[model samples]
Target: MSVTESKAKTSVKTSKKNVKPAEAAALKEALEAAQIELVPLSALIKSPLNVRTIPYPVESVRELAESIETIGLIQNLVVHTLPEGMSGVAAGGRRLAALQLLLTENRIDAGYQVIVKRVSDELAVVASMVENNQRVAMHPAEQIAGFRKLSEQGKSPAQIGDQLGYGSRHVQRMLKLAHLAPEILELLANNTLDVEQCQALSLESDQARQVQVYEQVKAAYSTVSAHLIKRVITETEISVTHPRFVFIGRETYEAAGGVVREDLFSQEENDGTADRVLVDRLVMEKLETAALAIELNEDWSWSIGRENPLQNYGEDRENYLLLPVPEPQYTPDEQQRLDELYATQAATETYEDEAAIQVLIDEIESQAAHRQWTDEQKASCGVVACLHNGELCILRGIQKKVKTPGEADAATQATSRDLHVIDRKEPDAAEGISLPLLKKCLPNAHWLFRLPWYNSHRKQWP
Candidate 1:
């Protein structure tokens, strides 16, 4: 017989036959304690006031069922006696579903007994709420350890998945954590490393490398994402879609022995697939070299190529007292082009077709670029090229510092406009005006001031 059947046979009420008063009292007290009775599956019903009236997640219920089938019910269900000799389950609704599933699969019979505790209606309701509300979910680290133990104990991935209500892939993913270094695993246990980061680190074959990257990232950033960790470990450079890469051409970059990191899971669509990243910074610098060569060919006074334009520009300003500020001035032709661009933009408000809208956008951008910097402006002003909207943009006519030799008390002012001052004191009232005339003309004057001044000047008044 099953454990449930064995327990059920001894769970029924027993006769308190001929006994001493003390023995009777002891039996009575024993009844107050929760007793494990294996009640029949057919006798069990759901409580209307049960906290979990709705079905639990199917996967969770399935897992519970698998566990019960494998190891028997571990916890006793809190139940209350209902009318017509029936028992209603106030708690363990998921357990009931799991038993039902086992019965359906012929793993257990309808007469299978489930361990339960008989309680009062009020106690049953409270028990149900407490059971659900006070329950804590197991941490991922704990789950990993559990699954690893099961695996070591001869449980296959499929078997583990079946017993845990998880898919085979999920089981496999969990198992992968077993390969992590002990230190890294300890980090996960203490909440230092999150699940996603752990998963990303798992992609690397070397535990030492994983630990190294984890420590490096944890030191640098408050939180490290999977994508960032992947990029770091992969040593990939800027994306091919970057404007500088496009400007230099992928063929030229690859011919120079640059590595490309392609997304392993990306798919090709009608438009295109995900862009790959360039992995060698040295090869990337070839574009800078080429640019420098062209700039030198133009006979520039001085030219420098840098991977990061803003940092270079900032460094250039560090030694100087002040940065050059570019003042933008438009020639007559450029101003006309700007006006035409604005006119076309206004015309687009009436455009309805997609093609026409795209054409208008192209025209607007072209005009804007054309009028951006005139030849005269480029000749006299400096330029900066930096990343903008994942592309390269050239900013022209940045101002250089003005040389003021031997000037004292140099200060930077946001603006040179004169401050406007307002005088609050009004024109003094006529010195010899009559008191009655003054009161009549200044009807809004304070009564107290008028009365005191009038009384003091009574002898001088007309």
Candidate 2:
């Protein structure tokens, strides 16, 4: 047999908790001390004032009763027969249902009262549900539905309360759930939403409004429950006015003719470099500016930032914004043109043109040929930073300092210097005379003497 059937068979009562062996022994001892009788199902006549006039249904109770009537009632149910000889359950709904069914099926008399251990009404109810449904929990939604059905049938909350043995407040709370929309009801059943959502929903009058926001909430997170939604909905406004979230499918992105550059995410994952992010920053800035420019009215325009990884990621690296913008739209003809013009992604790079980069390579190689560099590119490797003409230039491995006697004397005068002076160590060939001295220079000639950037931070250089 399945566990349910086996449990039902072994259980002496419906809606009753199982006995702890020690507790059961204690109860047995108490029963003996109280002088209670263990009566068979065949004894104790039913009272005229039974509160539950309509008996609960039971199966196989008849067979059991017949077996008892013929073989004699075996395994008498425990009971604390009152001085008045009345019967009530301490722990047996199933046993009572079986016996009652037997009587109803004419296998036994209706007047029979099955024995049960006498205990507090509280203990009886708690135990009853535990014995039957610790595994099969009656959902809160179903309970509310049942209460609503009874209420609709003209049962007052108090009457329902008495019948269910609960306070009127609980009945009212359950009744409120019936007011929510059908979709919300389903969420409750599915346990996607909970009491909190319901409580918040109760405050709202508009069903459509509730539904619109509910869908947004459901879309935002996969695992939240209906009860939770109820709670969240009250305090958090998730609906149309500044809706809490936007689920923009890629269609939306491409719909605006966004020409995506290289997928930054893939590059970020691959290179893990500051340079890649710099490209992203520039792209986002261009995209935002472009978006603003295209819109006829600034009031109607919208833009979103590329998420700042540092703001969210770490303290070691200060937060930096990604300035990239959405790609400009492509007209069909322009797209065709771009598709033909560019051969590969290398063609999309912005910082360098092929001719310009080739020139820089030639410059560095030529400098390397004559400069005395320790390791060419690294520290103490006799390198000078310089901006030759206008292009960014890096001359590697220059051995000699290009100072004339006067320049050498000036260098001695400019002491007590910060990192800029130290960094300005890259020699500017325009300011000096030595081929190898040009080695170790910044390709961008402008950076040779002092960059405006470092100066803003209060650092100065010669």
Candidate 3:
């Protein structure tokens, strides 16, 4: 017999020996009312009175089988006698199914014996209901402690999960909770901090820091949110979505000895945070290299790289002019394809399909033309490479030369005429001039000239 069965038999014998005369008679009567026997696995059938109507998951049954194989069944099935020597199980239906699974897998023989408590037919329903209703689930903290104990016993997460009918990742998550600071664990046990808050704390491996943050938040707010806890813990770190981190890329950043702390609860695969200084330096280096390449390939007079060009330049941004990008010219066949793509995009039923079609359209458009810079423009204009929305953006035709007052007035006149051409209905052409120019005849229209239709008509300008 297994250790479990031996202990069970020993306990029963001890209980019988300790019973008094009156109690012994009552025990005998109860034993006669419900007999315990070793019934054949094949002889047990699911009873009509079994409270659990929903079928057990296949994974649940498989895990149960693994548990039974490792440690013999600890509980006995409750069954009632039926005709022709068959017994209907009212309780422990999952256990019965698991045993059958083991038999089917050849882990156990077809004649394997299952321990069962045989009761009267009328008591079967009561037994099933009581068995299900009277049980209390283990608390999360207690579950975590149990998993930790199993881990301490040298069992791998996979093995522990198999015995407990949990996924290996779930077991690992619970084990992480086990490593939390004693104070944090106490908070979890006493319901002061929820599981999610503890999970947020787990992102920080330093128990001291976790406790510090917990105490700080507890004092600062009446109630703490999981997001707030995570933010406080990771305040100094750069999120994966940060422009610098995105520009450097996770692989390159890691290669440079940067560490990333991942959020296990996040649905996004790459959701994590990293050190800001390391990622910022990497971003600057990569941007500088990209700018150098662009300057050499395009024959620009000068090129400068900045993490954030607008922020770095500040008020000085007004000194330079942003040249508009030229429209792409496509052949008849390509244009037809583009039109068809747009039509299909408009009719697309799903966002995924529309995005895919847009990609194809972009590919065709990109092949049609490349940006061109006039020789005069190249001599006076430079390029600025900067990070925008986590992408490397190259701004060409950035005029660096300051304009003379006479030249500025002439340029303003030209802009006025162009604006007039656009809005022909306006009686006074001067009214078409942008507000910034009226305030001060600023030569650079980078800040004020932002009409959406201006790009398509840029080539028409003098």
Query: How would you encode candidate 3's per-residue C-alpha lDDT over 1-462 as one tens digit per residue?
Result: 000111122211100122234533643464467766898888988886564544567898899889999998888888888889888997788898899898888999867888888776544544554354334223456556556656766778776555444567667777887889989887766667777788789898899989998888888988776788998988889999776787788999999999999775566765889998888888888888887887888788888878664421334343555555445577899889977886776676775876577667656654453344567777776767777666776666676636687787575445433321121110112222234322344456565457644554444333
Taken over the whole model, the C-alpha lDDT of each candidate is 0.54, 0.40, 0.66
Rank by TM-score, highest first: 3, 1, 2
Task: List the candidate 3 regions with Cα displacement exceeding 4 Å.
Answer: 1-136, 241-244, 267-270, 308-317, 324-371, 402-462
Count of steric clashes across candidates, in order = 5, 58, 0
lDDT of 1 by residue, 1-462 (tens): 000111122221111123335533543453368788988998887775454533467898889898888898998888989988889897787788899888888989989988888877655544554355345333456556655756766778776555444556556667887677888777766666666667667756588989889878778888677777876775534555655566656676667666444332222211111223442353345535644553444332223334443422233443212122222245677557645654554444343442343344344343444344445544544433333332333333343445355432242221112111111111111222345644554567757444644554454345
TM-scores, all models, native as reference = 0.29, 0.27, 0.53
Q: In order, what is each prediction's RMSD in angstroms?
A: 23.6, 23.6, 17.9
In candidate 1, residue 383 scores what lDDT? 39
lDDT of 1: 0.54
